[model samples]
Target: MKRLLILPLLALSLIACEKDDDSTTNDPGNNGNSNPSALTNNMISVGTDSTSLNKYSAYVATDVNTNKTYFDIFIYKDDVLDRKQYMLLHLTEIPTASKTLNWQSGANAPGAIKADEFVIYPKVNDKRWFGVYSVSGYETTGTMQATVNNGKLTLSYEDIELADEFISVNVTERKKCSGKLTFLLSDLQGLTTTAQTLDLVAE
Candidate 1:
């Protein structure tokens, strides 16, 4: 009877050791190559007028290897006038200091407007402002200014519009976008918000 008891005890010990080994190997936090995922958030607000609908989505991400930051904002609007549209604003190499970036047509502005720097896609022609789908005649005109002060990030846009009335806008009337987004860098670092930036433009 003593021998039978000893055999069962030995088998239990072996099983426990196997489980411990598996747990250590499968732990995500222990993996050296694991990178943090993007954070994402959604917000809804009432439009200035009763007939308007406003929805905004924001995302923020930082690459652990390069420490580069990327941000994106999507705006959706609807109204009684059948004005259903979407606007996208993406930024790369975003300055942590107070600076303004702009993109225009047929002008050479260093660090201001480049395919790898900033993009504002208004869905004017069902094409993106950057990358392979970039429109030929369509041009993006906007200002993206950002400032990092007091451990907070302040982002603002002014009169950001897409020019090319025929194929891009698809409507006789033009649309102008302007807004402000402010949040604390500490909150983002803590992963307090679920907002994660998406890479709409590949550069």
Candidate 2:
């Protein structure tokens, strides 16, 4: 009788131990790091429009080595995302005298420009609204761009060129500007939908 009773007790103890192990493995919250397999790729956001042009801004950062760069997109009516970008370049790579490139209000093809009412502020404090002599112009190397949505503004060569670069925005205040609610990029690697409000203007 003693031997038989001991055998059952041992089996019950083994079952209890197995249950504990299974519980731990199924608890996803216990894992401190996010599971990479569940993440979306190349995530981006189409920002909300503001009442004042100076009130609208965004910043994007990417790793050139990773071949994943940030392209600033403008959101138009009817859920259309404009790919004609007002991009920020790393000015260090630009050569002297500047060159021409493409220019658009957003991330898609560009339309006509109301040249008289345009301004490009390289730094946030600079108050010089240069005219768009050429829609597609080049700038000095290593010059980054920031875009603002304040009606009409001038654009130059250094303002609209592409380089082998990547960017991330410092969105910390433009959260409640106006327009539509913020949405994250459903594509791209290691990106998120959690809204960030930063003011990074493009050249």
Candidate 3:
């Protein structure tokens, strides 16, 4: 009789263990190491010396289920105060350590579907307005490379040129507006939050 009771108790214990294991595996709170959704809400501001030109901002967002990544860049004209240019890129995966991102144009690109890519929106004139020069012409070209190591992020841009009409922005400019940024990422925990603004001065 005691053996029979022991068998039943053992069976119950095994069933409970299985249920606990299943519950842990299916838990929604288990977001591995990164929360793409949270990361999407974060924003990074890139500052330049040309205060009257434009202000630049970048964002990293992702959908883990679909394994899709969204990179967004915003250019706001300080003087206009009513118009802003936006550029967004969609990729198969979020940039974790290091990767090269290509520029995509058109109305069908990743962020394009949501009207988040290559768009200009009107804004109300406000004293706090800031902006970055429009790089609309070079949308089809250029590469963005980034690296993350030891909690430091390095972002570099290459071969990014301006349109003929806007050539003056580059002419006689020794820097040519191409440069790399290096900053600490201690504040950007889990890569889901925004780090502090970094200088993006040309050169």
Candidate 4:
């Protein structure tokens, strides 16, 4: 009985030691790599209505079960009327440098988003969500340029019009919104800081 107990104890100790030694993970988000943003205080300026969607915060997660890394910017206040509005930017790859990629997130509107597609989804609380696509030959014309460093982005849009989007959803239009606006990272407050300067071209 004594021998049996000793062997079990020894096995348990070895297992615990191994776990301690394996504390490190290969995840770029946790291993000091620029995979997911560690920066907080995120804000997005909706250009159309000239009403900035700076009502909340930004959330970051990594080592996802799906193995995808991305950050979210809250465009609407969470728990406000039991509603949550946010923008989800699913990182397509670990960007080594900043590039102005064509806005393709909502390209597959009224359909499933492509696996390789990089999109910014403005998610509403209900089943109805909307996607703003930057496709060519549309009445809407604009370009988005983004810079990602440490998983933080500076997204800017120039004179982009918001037409009827996916799922037959037109929240922006129903709300009467359109025009150029820049989306960037800042402290998570649904309201933009008054001290911060804004460009009023789209208005």
Best by lDDT: 1
Q: What are the per-residue Cα lDDT tens digits for candidate 3 across 4-24?
A: 111212211221232111111
lDDT of 4: 0.31
lDDT of 2: 0.20
RMSD of each: 22.0, 26.3, 22.6, 19.6
lDDT of each: 0.36, 0.20, 0.30, 0.31
Candidate 2 vs candidate 4: the TM-score winner is 4
lDDT of 1 by residue, 1-203 (tens): 00111121221122123211111111111101101121111111111111112433444544233455445444445321222344445554446566766543432222233443455544322222221113563344445556567876555554444332324433223334344444454433432113433211100
Stretches > 4 Å off in candidate 4:
1-48, 53-85, 94-96, 105-117, 123-129, 132-142, 148-152, 167-203
Model 2's C-alpha root-mean-square deviation from the true structure amounts to: 26.3
Flag regions of model 2 displaced more than 4 Å. Answer: 1-52, 61-67, 73-99, 103-203
lDDT of 4 by residue, 21-60 (tens): 1122111111011111322223332332232334323333
Best by TM-score: 1
In model 4, where is the ten-residue run with the lowest total lDDT?
1-10
Cα misplacement distance, residue 118 of candidate 2 (Å): 16
Descending-TM-score candidate ranking: 1, 4, 3, 2
